[model samples]
Target: MAFSAEDAKTASAVWEKIYADVEDNGAIVLSRMFKENPHTVSYFKNFTQLQSIPETASAEEIAALAEVRGHGKKVFSALNDLVSHLTNVDSLKATIVPLAKKHATELKVDVKDFGIIFENLLHLIGQKQGGDAKEAFEKVTNLIYEEIKAAY
Candidate 1:
């Protein structure tokens, strides 16, 4: 199933809540949410604080998390193509990069932001959870796209 605007809103709201919580406390709300709702843990990445102790996550940790998520997406997409076809699989990057390139002039944000967010989402799901979760992430991306459309 494709993602809806409401789905993006929900995801963004979740993200904002998690981010704000991380800013205010040392804990990640998403991680805690998973512990509280173990059944739904599949929806978010599990991050542990292993470095210097602080009341909240450091900016470096946040940046590293984002990088991990982006890298995870690239790996997940490659794996998906490999599993789907040994010789004639479609390239997710090729498909998505051109779309960003084509619409670079019209997007409200930088074209790279679209790719970065998409990649980050994928990375978070694939590496933190499992590669099988890419479909779910794709649905969320589709929902974000729909929401973006409605906005402008």
Candidate 2:
């Protein structure tokens, strides 16, 4: 289903707050992602650099976390653009097509991987803004997943 203009507005506003939090805590998100699916990290050439730190992280671990955070910023920057243009179907298609192609072909990302990421993302959003925001995310992310799956 196409997202309504109201949905787009809600999503755009929610994303600004969520993206800010995500940009700051991207490493935690990545850490959770890696913990749940270690194989996902293999897609990154720098996966080996990640430190297995818990209570007390060393300098190397800190650096690795920074790297993960940097990657998060890049990902969310794209997300910011996509969300910002949710009301524009042409713009959305332009962004998702190339991104989906890279993900499907170069990264060989499975559809299931998108589900996992979205699940965690929604959970994070739920923590921040409760049900309405998640409902908006649910609609938008499903649309994104469908678009990506089509390209795949």
Candidate 3:
């Protein structure tokens, strides 16, 4: 479905708040994803050893968190790119398609995992920003998912 101007405005406003603390918010979303869906960790090599680590403030644990935070920043940066182009579907698709292909081919990420991440992100938005932000993002997420699915 096409993203309406109003929806874009609403999503952009909510996204601006999230992007203000993109690294932390992205890490929170990704950390939740790993915690809730342990199977997803298989796709992340750096995170594999983390599963074996005990729940203590060890070097490995700290390093893993730092890796997660760094990766989270990249994820949010890509998201910011997409969100900024919401008003232009051509630009959005152009941006997403290559990333989608890379995930499918290079990263070998299961397309379904994208949906899971979106669920976690939506939940975070709902928890922190409330229903309206969540609702707006739901539409944007669906559009993104569709594009990724098509690429896959």
Model 1 spans > 4 angstroms off: 1-108
Candidates' RMSD to native: 15.2, 3.4, 3.1
Evaluated at residue 48, the lDDT of candidate 3 is 45
Q: lDDT for model 1, please.
A: 0.39
Tens digit per residue, CA lDDT, model 1, 1-152: 33355554444443333233332222232223223334322223333322221235453443345433453344344333322322221333334344444444443344334444455445554554466455544555554444333333
Estimate the TM-score of every prediction: 0.32, 0.84, 0.89
Tens digit per residue, CA lDDT, model 3, 1-152: 66789899999999898889987888877777777777776777756445554243343343348767888789889999999889898999999999999999999999999999899889989998999899988988999999989988
Q: Of the pair 1 and 3, which is ahead by TM-score?
A: 3
lDDT by residue for model 2 (47-114), tens: 43564443254423543576777876776677777787677777788888999889888888776787
Model 3 lDDT on a 0 to 1 scale: 0.83
For TM-score, candidate 2 versus 3, the one ahead is: 3
**Reference-based lDDT, each prediction:** 0.39, 0.71, 0.83
Least accurate 10 contiguous residues by lDDT in model 1: 80-89
Question: What TM-score quantifies how close candidate 1 is to the native fold?
Answer: 0.32
Candidate closest to the true structure, highest lDDT: 3
Q: On a 0 to 1 TM-score scale, where does candidate 3 land against the true structure?
A: 0.89
Q: How far off is residue 96 in model 2, in Å?
A: 0.5
